[model samples]
Target: MDNMFRLMGSEEFSDRRRCIWVNGPVIIGAGPSGLATAACLHEQGVPFVVLERADCIASLWQRRTYDRIKLHLPKNVCQLPKMPFPENYPEYPTKRQFIDYLESYANRFDISPQFNECVQSARYDEVSGLWRIKTTTTSSIAGSEMEYICRWLVVATGENAERVVPEIDGLTTKFEGEVIHSCEYKSGEKYRGKSVLVVGCGNSGMEVSLDLANHNANPSMVVRSSVHVLPREIFGKATFEISMMLMKWLPLWLVDKLLLILAWLILGNLTKYGVKRPNMGPMELKVVTGKTPVLDIGAIEKIKSGDVDVVPGIKRFYRNHVEFVDGQRLNLDAVVLATGYRSNVPSWLQENDLFSKNGFPKSAFPNAWKGKSGLYAAGFTRKGLAGASADAVDIAQDIGNVWREDSKIHKMRSRVVYRRCISLA
Candidate 1:
């Protein structure tokens, strides 16, 4: 891998082709997908330099996520290639453990990405067959705007780039107390002993509420809808094992019903605490179809124990008071919104009409853009917590296959790219 990077890095680049350093392929986002893709590319003799927007690797882990977060997937299945967590680590690593694992992975793979440099825009130059990438950051030794011209561009930026704060009516104008997005959440110490409202029941929501409960914060979870909340460890085995064993054969509807029934039998209505299990089927197919298991986080248990209060969705907020859809109102100290995130592709591409109708850059696999430019996207979709690991495997496999094919045709093509410029401008 080192030999490959050295070889590619030494290649002579055109000075006229100013964009990237013209070292090798350019990768955006130094999160899990970026690191994994870099590892595979290194092993396969592909040279790439990763551009990160944060001050360190795994910024999401170190910055965005809350304390006490744990991987829902078991450690074994979620392990990365060529790098595994130490045996002494927990079966399901905590947020800190995960950060250590990623840091170790980056070190082992020799992925010294330039930190604090955020990519602003990237465009493919058809005439030069190079990708022109621009950035806004102080880290670049070359000064303000750095450029890179490369044959390929790989976007390893995962889906969790931008937090999805909902545009609630009167939220900005009326609300008073501390209102923060999930991405800004660091700990629950501030909410301790205070009435807190946590919106969203996804893994983040569950974990946050539990943390607040553990801290005796008296937090209340606002569940807007129904979701399948499964035990992380079921019957001394990972719930994914059960899901794989049972969910595959049974129809989705049946599986949803069965899981709900089982949860009800074990956990009860959950409504008294304010959580309502859907009567029909799973709200999202992503949960029902995939074997990704949701952690219960004992939020229901917290509610049952009266540590955490479960409440309906927020109807409105006035000063330090909150109104719910149930026509109930309460005064709260803080509101932590666990609302999800949107995939933020760099600006250059966004302005060029590159994304699909769904906002994802159009590509089938590892490659995000299915054009002759060889631009690919590594991870722009959220599969789960283990999504980083899962996506790494798939992207590595695809990049390997694509690189092999490109290598074979490398010598057959003309050295210079001559493209007739068409005026779309």
Candidate 2:
């Protein structure tokens, strides 16, 4: 790799093009997917550099999530390749605990990432068969710039890079109350004794409403569309674990049917609690559309008990109240938009063909890790951490194969050149 770059003469390469060369792959984002990819590459004896925009690893888990957040999936399923959560951890670890676990995992493997370095842009140089990456470090006041060239580029930035706050009519100027997205929400202490309207009914929306209710806030949720709400546990075990076990033996249709029946028996009729259930089953929805089902913790109980009220989607916002689509209005002190996020992969990705019309990876699971023009996407899987780990393994294997083949070809070409030179001498 060094020799290939050295072969470029001064006439062909300018001083600006002589960037810091990284012989191996360059992994972006130091979250779960990035770290997992690094670990896999290390195991294959492949040297790589990890670049993190934040000051620490797992910035999403460390900063973006709310204080009371916890992993919806069980610890076993969420564990990385060889590192498992502490034995003493709860079935579902809290956000802080999960962040600690990530930190420990990175430290245990000696996976040191370049922190505070945000990737500004990456362009593939066809002539050199490498990726030219421009980055800006956040540590300095002037934002020092740096460049690097690598053979392969791995984009491990997860799905939730940018917050998606739905636009509401009259929300900007008419509403005088506080407005926030779920990403900015920490706790409900500031909302105490206030009538808060939480938009969207996903997992975060449900949990945040419950947190507000518990903290003395009169909370109401906006059920914009149909959603599948499931109990966190069934009988004596986690519902996710039960579903996984059933999936192993039963077909998808039958598994969905059984899970639906179980959910109906445990949670009773969601319609009775003003929560509208989608026509599709939870498992089916996840498999078909990749939409996450809201895993109920204590939110359903609160809703049924009249602590958290349910309302239709918002029509518009008023000076001191919000008008619902059903022609009803409620006086609210604040509005929390738990509308979720969109993938920011297109922001810095020069190759537009690598993304779909919706800006998501064009490829599906198992194949999503590989993209066009020597690009790879990680952590975009529907199965979350488990899917990401699997994708990392596939990516590492593919990269290793390509690298080996390229090395062999380069060696053959070098031998041919040497023989020709000896004959000329």
Candidate 3:
């Protein structure tokens, strides 16, 4: 790889257009997806820069997630491209354990990312056939703007960039109790004897409610619509592992039928507890609508044992009480909006082709990673870490091939970029 700017020393310049040129791709996140891509690229002898908005790698895991959250999937599927989890780790690693694994993986690969540099905007320069990325640093050298010009822009930011907070009627004005998103919530110790309203019945919501119930808090989970709740394990093996095994032999529909049959036999009918299954099978629903099924991990048992209440959607909030869609009203002390997350691509990425208005790639998984003008995505796949790892490997291989071809004739005496652009690690 060639360096466009030879002046590695800090310098000031008024010309903003003349930026530091990255000989390889400029990855957007320092999360698992981004780290995996960087490691794979390193193996291919490619030099790249990773820019993270946060101070540390895996900010979501380190700063945002609750303390009790573990890897929903098995460690085998959650591992990155090149590094495998430690043999001593549990089947489902804890949050801290997963973060530790990512740290070790980064250390093993010597992947140093430019931390606290948040990308403000990234646009493809049609004239230069390169991507121009503008960012602002939040570190001690704060409020300073920096730009990077690179041939490739790998968007490894992943699916959950921003937390989704729904605008419910009277949510802000009428509610007298404390309301916080799931990302902001860590534990239920403070809410020990209080009634907590948990919104959105996704995996996070279910898990959060379970945590609250375990902590001796009254948590009423709201099931707004139909959802698929599957057992985390079928018999003794992991349900996901069984699904993968069956997928290799049987058709998706057939596998779904078998899995549902097993789920029914094990968990019984969920309708009795106010839980409704979606019309589409779990896998089919996930593939068609990107809605993941809830893998039961003691939450359903809590609901069945009357430790956690399963309620309907919220109509509005009235003082310290919530009115459900089914005309049931209950007084609650706090509300935890486990509404999940969305991609921030549409907010900063100044492009229209590769990503849709909703910040997801227009194309589906597998094909969603690569796009025109060297734009790529890593973790947008609804299939979770396993899918993201697949995308990371594919991206590295593609960029490595081009880098190999370019190195054959790349010369040292190349034009240097202007002083305005900073060369980050």
Candidate 4:
């Protein structure tokens, strides 16, 4: 079943100095937490190997999102563990039906992921305890290089892996138009009537300014500070299922004062449509700053029906307008930015104390999936796909208890090398 997601032939991986030793667990990023850690290490029979840099398998929901994204959480809290999304999908599943339910949950667990192969460097040998990695494969023919040597690595490259772009002091030579970065946006069909802007109010700058105001463009957004928008439904269910039933029967400051009085009696006073509200509470700023509460899927009724338009942050960028910091300006022809994404995991971890100068993982939510030495990480727990299916069932039961104590020390070192080859016969 693992013809490594089929389509092999380049004389099959075209041996670039063949060195595929797997033992078990290598994972990197076939997305959706590396196919939920390859369906929990193929249900613990183990022998893993995912890799994917993206030729398929949920390449950030197949090709970096937006064409009207979706799954702003639902589909029963974004399933994965026993693979669920289909039963007539749509509690909010769009990015191409969540990339066709992640290619049918990687062919219902046959899970072959090599894909475009990227990893480019892993390192962690310390006298061969094992984890070398080093990938790179233009999918064979004129480009190839591989090397694995596993025994447990798992990263799952989750935190978007780069795309924050915000240093705006005239974003590199006064915007003359078309800047883009909501991961290279998608529809707004060549920005129809054109005007764009979008910057960042999170949730991909309020769903790409309500998809450039339902594709007639003119958009706007920006906001830049104070957020927490949430509202993909309120009494009719799913405001993240009533904030997970008030965070499972109230407490964290009474589930942030009852979801801030049910988001001020259902999203009213969005600072009278200039949108400000951020004195914390959106489940306490997603529990003290993981920050991600902009779920209002209709983009606040297209920013209160002015067909988007909010502005407030960027104070520079001229050659045709963009000075805001509330001093006001305008003229924009295109901007996008939707400003978000980080975690490149210090570009292949040269072990800077297992991260956290903001590069994340210093062990927090559900123990950031165990990362010290043998390293683990899976989906960086921003709680997407229920925290990457509970960090792929606790990293497949901690790599099936280190593959059963390394198979009982390789059967007691093969019975002490058969009693030293029967005392050298």
Best by lDDT: 3
Q: Candidate 3: deviation at residue 61, Å? A: 0.6
Candidate 3: worst-modelled 10 consecutive residues by lDDT? 1-10
Superior by lDDT: candidate 2 or candidate 4: 2
Q: Give the alpha-carbon lDDT of every model.
A: 0.71, 0.86, 0.90, 0.79
Indicate which candidate wins on TM-score.
3
Model 4 stretches with alpha carbons more than 4 Å out: 1-16, 22-24, 29-143, 147-155, 159-176, 182-196, 203-219, 222-248, 251-257, 262-268, 274-292, 295-330, 339-377, 380-393, 400-402
Instruction: Write candidate 3's Cα lDDT for 272-359 as tens digits.
Output: 9989988789888887989888999999999999999999888999988999988989998999999999899998999888899999
Candidate 1 positional error at 344, Å: 0.8
- For residues 13-105, could you state the per-residue lDDT of candidate 4 as single tens digits? 456466676767788888888898889888887878888877877777667777778888778878889878878987888888788888888
Question: How does model 2 score by TM-score?
Answer: 0.92
Q: In model 4, how large is the Cα lDDT of residue 12? A: 40
Arrange candidates by TM-score, descending: 3, 2, 1, 4
lDDT of 1 at 273: 63
Candidate 1, residues 283-317, lDDT tens digits: the string is 23554333223468577688788887778877888
Sequence-dependent TM-score of model 1:
0.83
Give the candidate order by descending lDDT. Answer: 3, 2, 4, 1
- Stretches of candidate 1 off by over 4 Å are 1-18, 140-143, 247-251, 279-284, 287-293, 346-354, 361-372, 385-425
Give residue 138's lDDT in candidate 1 (0 to 100): 66
Cα lDDT tens digits for candidate 2, 1-425: 65445534435346554356787899999999999888888777778899999998998888788999999999998988768889999989999899889989888777999999899999887766778788898999988878877878999988888899777997988999999999899999999999999998999999999999999999999887888888889997899999999999998889888888888898888987778778887888887789988899999989999999999978999999999989999998999999998887777878766677565777777677787667888888888999988878888888888877888899999999999999999
Give the range where candidate 1 is weakest over 10 consecutive residues by summed lDDT.
416-425
* Residue 335 shift from truth in candidate 2, angstroms: 1.1
What is the alpha-carbon lDDT of model 2 when measured against the actual structure?
Answer: 0.86
| Count of steric clashes across candidates, in order | 9, 0, 0, 0
Q: List the residue pairs that clash in candidate 4.
A: none
